[model samples]
Target: MRARLMEATVELLVERGFAGTTTTLVSERAGVSRGAQLHHFPTKNALVVAAVEHLTERRGEELSRAVDALPAGGNRTRAVVAMLGDHFASPVFAAALELWVAARTDEALLAAVAPLEQRVGREAHRMTAAALGADESRPGVRELVQATLDLVRGLGLASTISDDSTRRRRILGEWADVLDREMARA
Candidate 1:
């Protein structure tokens, strides 16, 4: 039921936007009673926070699975950029962009997004470090992991709003080139 409510909240976010989303609307969309929504969420921001958390976790899971296909080595550098490039080209990316924009003015939403963002950074570092088989504490490897995460966000933004696939590919290629260099160094 919480999942259903969160899913409805996301849909509401995409459709009615933050200003328009309400527990009443979310409950209606989720086919739950208003009392049920109150029982589950207690507040609009709480529901929105859960929705954003759900979206972030969903994306993180998908990213982990997609990047898992790459071999644990320098070769995965390009594959990381390409696979994530493909991921950002999806509708989910656009939805995420919407949530990010909403989070900018909403402190509660920002708070909700903060831990998830940090977790993503940590996970990306772990994955890249694993690919390079680096000592987890290595400084250079940490930098590369951070850069890779930034690249993913930039690529996701470009893919979400840009009309040019060529541009997205070019950026992905550039990120791949950078990763290729760093992965070798590590």
Candidate 2:
């Protein structure tokens, strides 16, 4: 029941930003009673925050599985970029983007979301480093990994409003090439 409510919350958030995702809507979407939602979540902030955390954790797990499934000793950089591109283009990213925009002005939302964002960011960095087979012990590798994430995130944001796949694919290829060259130098 709790999981259903959270799933509904994420769906509503992704489909209709924060302003439109009310407790009533979530309950209706989840097929749960309002009282049940309140019993589980207590507040809209609590529900929204829980939904974000739940989705992030699920996505992280899915990412791990995808990365694990990649062929060993091949072009990991391209594979990682492709995986991240798909992730950024996903409904999960859209939901997170909605939370991010709302969090900018709402202190309560920010307070709830900031830590979750940091946790997700850390996991993303760790995943990218692992996927790229990066030597984090190296001085420049960490920054390069972060830059790659930043670039993919920007591309993902662009994809939310428009079909930027062509440009994103080109940038991913170029970035992967540049990253490979730089890592070779390092």
Candidate 3:
């Protein structure tokens, strides 16, 4: 029941920004009774915030699982970049974006999300470094990893506005090349 409501909330958040995803809409979409929904999440903020956290955790786990499938040699750098890009461009990311945008102006939402965002950011960095075989103890490696994450996040934002697959692919390829060179230097 909790999972259903959270999943529905994430879907609605992606389809219709934060302002449009209401508790009533979520209940109907989840096919859960209003009483049950309210019992689980008493307020809209409570429901949406919990939903965003749930999706964020799921997205991170999915990325971690997919990392195992990444190519071990050859254009592995490119593969890693592509994998990270795809993860950021997923629907769950979009839903998180909606929550982030709303949280910027809503104190209550911000209070709930700021810590989660920080944790997610740290985990993403850790995972990206691990996937790329990057050792941050070396000079410049930490910055390089951060740059890769920032670049992919920007790509994700661009994707939300339009169909950016072609351009994003090209950019990721170029970035992969640069990352390979930089990582080698570091």
How displaced is residue 95 in candidate 3, in Å? 0.7
Encode model 3's per-residue lDDT on 32-92: one tens digit a residue: 9999888889999899889988888987888888887776979888888998998888899
Candidates' TM-scores? 0.78, 0.96, 0.97
- In model 2, which range of ten residues has the least summed lDDT? 72-81
Clashing pairs in 1: none
- Kindly list the per-residue Cα lDDT of model 2 for residues 131-181, writing each as its tens digit: 888888888989999998888889889999989988888889888888888
Give candidate 2 misplaced runs (Cα > 4 Å). Answer: none
Candidate 2 has which clashing residue pairs, if any? none
Model 3 weakest lDDT span, ten residues long: 62-71
TM-score, candidate number 2: 0.96
Q: Which one wins by TM-score: 1 or 3?
A: 3
Order of the predicted models by lDDT, top scorer first: 3, 2, 1
Model 1 reaches what TM-score against the true structure? 0.78
Highest lDDT, which number?
Answer: 3
Report the Cα RMSD per candidate: 2.9, 1.1, 0.9
